[model samples]
Target: MVTKTIEVVNAQGIHMRPAGMLVAEMKKFPNCNVTLKCGEKTAKATAVMQIMASGIKCGSKVEITAEGENEQAALDKAAELFETGFGE
Candidate 1:
């Protein structure tokens, strides 16, 4: 398992488009268990609605976790996506 920390940088946060993108990326790794969290709220990264509902405002700190054989790569990719501002 691996967990990486990042801050939301997209001006609009993780809105619908970015949330869908994140979910789609997450779904590519079936053996992984992914989780996204902001402060005390956490949800499965596989769920678009749950991620959007996080209300993770810009600059909010977030934790991305992945557990599986490919945990490190999964976490790294997620961190890269967030660090890139979700392609904003």
Candidate 2:
């Protein structure tokens, strides 16, 4: 498993558009399991609704975990997305 903690830099946080983008990207790693943790909330990276429901905000710190096949690649991609603020 691989993990990285990053801050949510997008002004809108992980809204519908970014959530959808995350889901789409994470889905590419079918063999890997991606999870996001923020405060007391935990969500599957590929679940848009769960991600939005986590209440992630601009300054929120998120812990991303990727396990199983291609875990590093999955983690790297997720980290990149967060670092880029989902291209907001």
Candidate 3:
């Protein structure tokens, strides 16, 4: 397993829109299993509702973890999304 810490750079955080986008991206990596944690909340990366429910606002610390065949790539991509503010 591998993990990366990133901040939510978007002003609105991971609302429904970005949650949907993130979940979509996560779903593409079938060989990798990923999860996201913010504060006391943790959610499977493939679950849009759970991700949005994480209540990760701007500047919030997010821990992303991935394991399996594509763990490295998956973690890297997920971290990039957080760094980019989910494309704002």
Candidate 4:
């Protein structure tokens, strides 16, 4: 498993749109299992509502984790998205 911590840089934080985008990305890799956590909340990466519920505002640190055959790639992609603020 791999985990990377990053901060959200978008002004909107983790509203529905960005959350959906992140879920879509997470869903693209079936070979890997990905999860996210912020503060006291933990959720599967593809769980849109759970992710949104994390209340990960701009600058909030989030941890993205991945495991399985494609863990490294999955973690890299997820980290990229978070680091880019989901391409705000």
The lDDT per prediction is 0.88, 0.94, 0.89, 0.87
Model 2 ranges off by over 4 Å: none
- Residue 41 local lDDT, model 1: 88
Judge candidate 1 against the unseen true structure and give its global Cα lDDT, from 0 to 1.
0.88
lDDT of 3 by residue, 1-88 (tens): 9998888889988899888888888888998889998999999999988887788898899999999988998898898888887777
Q: What alpha-carbon RMSD in Å does predicted model 2 have with respect to the real structure?
A: 0.6
Clashing pairs in model 4, backbone N/Cα/C closer than 3 A: none
Question: Model 4's lDDT to the true fold?
Answer: 0.87
**Which should have the higher TM-score, number 1 or number 2?**
2
Model 4, stretches more than 4 Å misplaced?
Answer: none
Please, what are the lDDT tens digits per residue for candidate 4 over residues 1-88? 8888988898988888888988898888987889988999998898998988888898888898899878998899888887877777
lDDT of model 1, residue 71? 85
TM-score of candidate 2 relative to the true fold: 0.97
What is the per-residue lDDT of model 1 for residues 1-88, given as tens digits with 9 covering 90 to 100? 7898999999988898888888888888889999998988897889988888888889899999999868888788888889998888
What TM-score goes with each of the models?
0.95, 0.97, 0.95, 0.93
Q: Which candidate ranks first by lDDT, i.e. highest?
A: 2
For candidate 2, lDDT tens digit of each residue in 1-88? 8899999999988899889999999999999999999999999999989999998999999999999999999999999999998888
- Write down the RMSD of candidate 4 (Cα, Å): 1.0
